[model samples]
Target: MARDSLIRHYAYLVRVVVGRLVPGGKSRLEVDDLVGSGIAGLIRAVDTYDPAREVKFETYATANIRGAVLEAIRNEDFLPRSIRDRLRAFDRASLATEVRIGRPATDHELANELGVTEEHVGRLRIAAVASRVGSLDDSTSGSEGDTLRFGDMVADPSVDLDRELQDNEVREALTNALGHLPERERTVVGLYYTENLTFLEIGRVLGISESRAYQLHGQALSRLRQRFRPMLMAA
Candidate 1:
């Protein structure tokens, strides 16, 4: 395909990937900026793609596009260091509280643990979710010291056949995990990921405050992360 034609035809892929990465307008970067970077990746993919490879062009191009968007975000360093530190402190306090109580910690409990108001905890929760967007590009060490990206593990429709079976297994495990979540947590996860709704929108739909929705999101992610630990370690 001519380069311009290829870009025009596949441009929607950029928006799709961007929506997944920055759902709910959570990121500091504008959607247009991210899309611009993704287009660069698509152009690069067109120039370098080898049709003889087993992978589909869409699969290959998606990876490039995602990488470009992430790189742009990293270069910008959108999250302030103070916020990152607070997020780490919040995670620690949350885990400690959960261990002591034998259940997920509530926002009030976390606030008391951290010596902050519940309102601050709410901001921290929002920051935590925002931080996760950049975390997609983070590298994970496998049992054998090989490196993998969190983004690569997320199931993509265009994944090559070699990864199809593994992706299926992951999806099955996720389905089972989702089944195990409490009704509200499950609903939050569904609306956030499946429906691509923001926490604010989810709050309106579920008739809860936005902070409450964020709390549920954090709790659900903690549960899902625990379930995925073994898979990540063995990867």
Candidate 2:
């Protein structure tokens, strides 16, 4: 009964972890699948947790849940070989452009370098980010059957602030990275992560196509990931 009660009480945590890991429903894996994996992780946390560790259960369980979801995603070879080849080609072209120009390459530059159209590059960028981390749009179902955007949940004050505060270093690094982004890229990040706008909505706000918005988001994330790599690895 205690285990079952623990699972029941912490079930919402599974959804939270799933929402954070796979923000948009763009992954080949469904939200339900990731939620199932997260629940398994939560159950494991409940079984293995140590009261004397001086760590909060929520924090410990969060790590476990994230790991489980990531593991589930990794176990699936979801991308086609053709897409994988394109992703590799895009990466090579991006690096070459960066080296040649002494700066991160824009999507247009990379497309030209790779002998592909800008739209092709845009899709590749979207695929690149999606393969690593899910998209920034879309919503997941909350524990009570209500739709909840992860961004909104993050902004909600009722969520545990202490858990958030524990990641001050990462948060600070991200803020600094965002400040360094180009104006347009920064706007896309804010609108996507803060305003919780889908790429289509962001496009309308910025007077661009939805695909262009995705390209900007992907570029912003690539830069942020480069900056955050060290901190994230240590974390």
Candidate 3:
């Protein structure tokens, strides 16, 4: 098929992907804003498309469309390095915890595992949201565990709404802990816990050496544990 025909067919799907990734956008940036990312992927796919490649266009095209979206998002000044670090840490811990438990890990369980307060765990979720960049063609997470495994947040059938509210209150407590952290501590702690960026990535963003990044993240976690442990212990 010609390039224009291919473009006409796939444009709508690409737009929807962008809309989902960036929930609150004003829509001034037309769906075509994501086209560049899609086009790049499509061009690559097309060049690589083998006559012997038994795969259909939809599979190939969807990837192209997602890639476009991710590319566009990366252009934005996205999440800070601290948040990224926390996200990585959360992902790593979740994977390991699941393996150990032989079941999915709860958000609360994860917070405890990382030695951070439950409030910071909520902040980690808020930061886990992806950017509007077209799909990167590569996944950041290797664990194919269910995305909805954070069952602590899911509504329970037997519990009344009031009880659910209480559960949310605990989640809110975790968020509050994150809010109370100093800006540097907040950033470093997230890097160390949620995003799980290696010290190298954290240092690159922080303008410090790899070892320095590790030092900062370690110290940040130590201080947070010290400050919050008393309150949690008392409570």
lDDT, candidate 3, 1-235, per-residue tens: 8866766766666655454443232234544566556666666655655445444565555544544444455444344445435544665565445445544466688788899887775544433322111112211221222121112122221122243335555456446766777776677656644565555776777888866665664454445444444332232
Worst 10 residues of 3 by lDDT: 131-140
Residue-wise C-alpha lDDT for candidate 2, range 17-112, written one tens digit per residue:
676556453444577888988899899889987767555677667656765665565455344455545555665565445435544466577778
C-alpha local distance difference test of each model: 0.59, 0.59, 0.48
Q: Which model is ahead, 2 or 3, in terms of TM-score?
A: 2
Q: Give the per-residue Cα lDDT of candidate 3 at 201.
A: 71
Query: Candidate 2 overall Cα lDDT vs. reference?
Result: 0.59
Q: Which has the better TM-score: candidate 1, or candidate 3?
A: 1
Q: Candidate 1 clashing pairs?
A: none
What does the lDDT come to for candidate 3? 0.48
TM-score of model number 3: 0.33
The 10-residue segment of model 1 with minimum total lDDT is: 138-147
Specify the poorest-scoring 10-residue window by lDDT in model 2.
152-161
- Candidate 2 deviation (Cα RMSD): 14.8
